[model samples]
Target: MNMNKKELPSLLLLPGLLCNERLWQNQVNNLVDICQPFVADFSQDDSIEAMARRVLDRAPEQFFLAGLSMGGYVAFEIMRQAPERVTRLALFDTMARLDEPERAATRKGLLRLAEEGRFIGVTPRLLPNLIHKDKLNTPVADEVMKMAAELGKEVFLKQQTAILNRSDSIPTLSKIKQPTIIVVGEDDKLTPPEESVNMAKAIPNAQLHRIPKCGHLPPLEYPQLTTELLRDWILQEA
Candidate 1:
């Protein structure tokens, strides 16, 4: 290991549903100069509490924590479970509330498809909901599909179950003492920018940013911008 690398702070990143380490590959590679980034494996757990516990068990004693979508749910659990260990918080394309009836129904329907062995991750019909319309034909869309396919059905099942059962985190937002940032894609249809707005308002001194023409998976959809945003957040004075 490089001696200087030891001096860098740890940055623990958690990915969303059907996403693996590949979801954060760009940020991991680009942010190496300022922080040691670690992507947690969220595939084994069937609940957010269990996922958060698994991450806390393996994460550094103290570190910066960031999560996207389903990962955001786990991040909230981590804060509740071990707030002292998190130096800062960053939420991307996620919300603090539990699923609405319509959303829950959609998730349940997808779960049924997977259970029936008909899981086709991130198909063309679903791409619009996950990314900006302009990116539908781009490599970014391909990467999203690739990630889903790579993680496959079992991981999807676990993630969906965890998300479905996650707690309502809005009430706990004001209690977060860490310097926090909430980011969302301007064109994000799933979580939407409004969700980030509500989170920013709830968390004390939290900063909110909306990336234009992007969607739920900003780290992959706009890697350079996402890297810069994270780099700035990591270096910002608390």
Candidate 2:
């Protein structure tokens, strides 16, 4: 493998909805020894295709890729557009199907709240759904809220729009040959564990990991474990 004088392959981390570089800050800092990490700016576009293009424009020629939640949607789109560029894949708390009617309606309601200026960031009603119930008041939970709040309205709308219009990626799954890992929280109310399992099953040579006591935001709730898992995933095919 061409290391470009770097010790390990480049790893591109795509954050979920309303997330920023801070989303992968931990992994970036922790995995520095094994990978040259870059976190994508997902706020620059309103469609998954556009977002993938932007990220691809800046990413290394080839890299390991990871996406969580909404990022997973964008990941699938990226894989659709450039399967050859991806060396491996890591999907966390994500799904390959188009949004369910109920979930789409819920997203519309949240977007409505944002439009009405009622709640710019993720609101209290939605916070509990994001983290494990026991961790609702933890620092990690606060950080997630802070990230959402700081990203604010424009970003929220753009991401939600991208997610709402994202294609059902199941058709593309069978074609993914990269070494992949699907990670999810056991208590994730948003995407749940079964989705990760199903996604792992759909992708060729994919692994599945369930973080106990975690919720939608596993990176925040289990930063060290998540980072470690990601590091291992990167090395699997290296």
Candidate 3:
């Protein structure tokens, strides 16, 4: 099942907050030649567990799974439900910790705003925190704004509320024995490198990699690194 072989494992990419399939466009295109990659849809589900179930319901019998930010939370739930089904794991710019009280409170506030038809505020206020200081002024900011626009107010509220209530999966990482990769952007502010370090240490057989000059949305900010690491990790496990 190594890279030396031709039949690579299927890869399922889960996007971060307020994102859809467009988030993984670069990864999809870059890795399509090496392996089959599908972007999981979570807009229909309002809870992390339910989202995981929805994705699993449509996933192949067995394959590699990867996710970012909130999607990382769902990926862990998938691991909990169908550990035997995952051949490999990759988590990018995500944390293994549960929502602390302060974080939960912030999420709730954002959820409330979204519920009140404030999707516009969510993007501007939140996007800066996700990326590095320099990126806040670049085209990346415009891109993020455009993506958030696609999510709409209703989806924003649902996703934010779901993140506010997500369960702690730090303890579950140790139980996962598959070849796992923990990726973090060097410039990500939302989920710091410390978070990825903790996740790498907790997950069995996991390796951590950093994408320089990238932010929380590495799949979009540095798609080449994301695709290369994902491809390498899945192939190494095979």
Runs off by more than 4 Å, candidate 3: 1-8, 121-125
lDDT of 1: 0.92
Query: Poorest 10 consecutive residues of model 2 by lDDT?
Result: 1-10
The weakest ten consecutive residues by lDDT in model 3 span: 1-10
How does residue 158 of candidate 3 score in lDDT?
76
lDDT of 1 by residue, 144-210 (tens): 8998999899999988988898999999999998999999999999998999999999999999999
List the candidates' TM-scores in order: 0.97, 0.95, 0.91
Write candidate 3's Cα lDDT for 194-218 as tens digits.
9999888888668999878887888
Where is model 2 more than 4 Å wrong at Cα? 1-7
C-alpha lDDT of all candidate models, in order: 0.92, 0.87, 0.81
Q: Identify the leading candidate in terms of TM-score.
A: 1
lDDT of 3 at 98: 82
lDDT of 2 at 122: 68
The prediction achieving the highest lDDT against the true structure is: 1
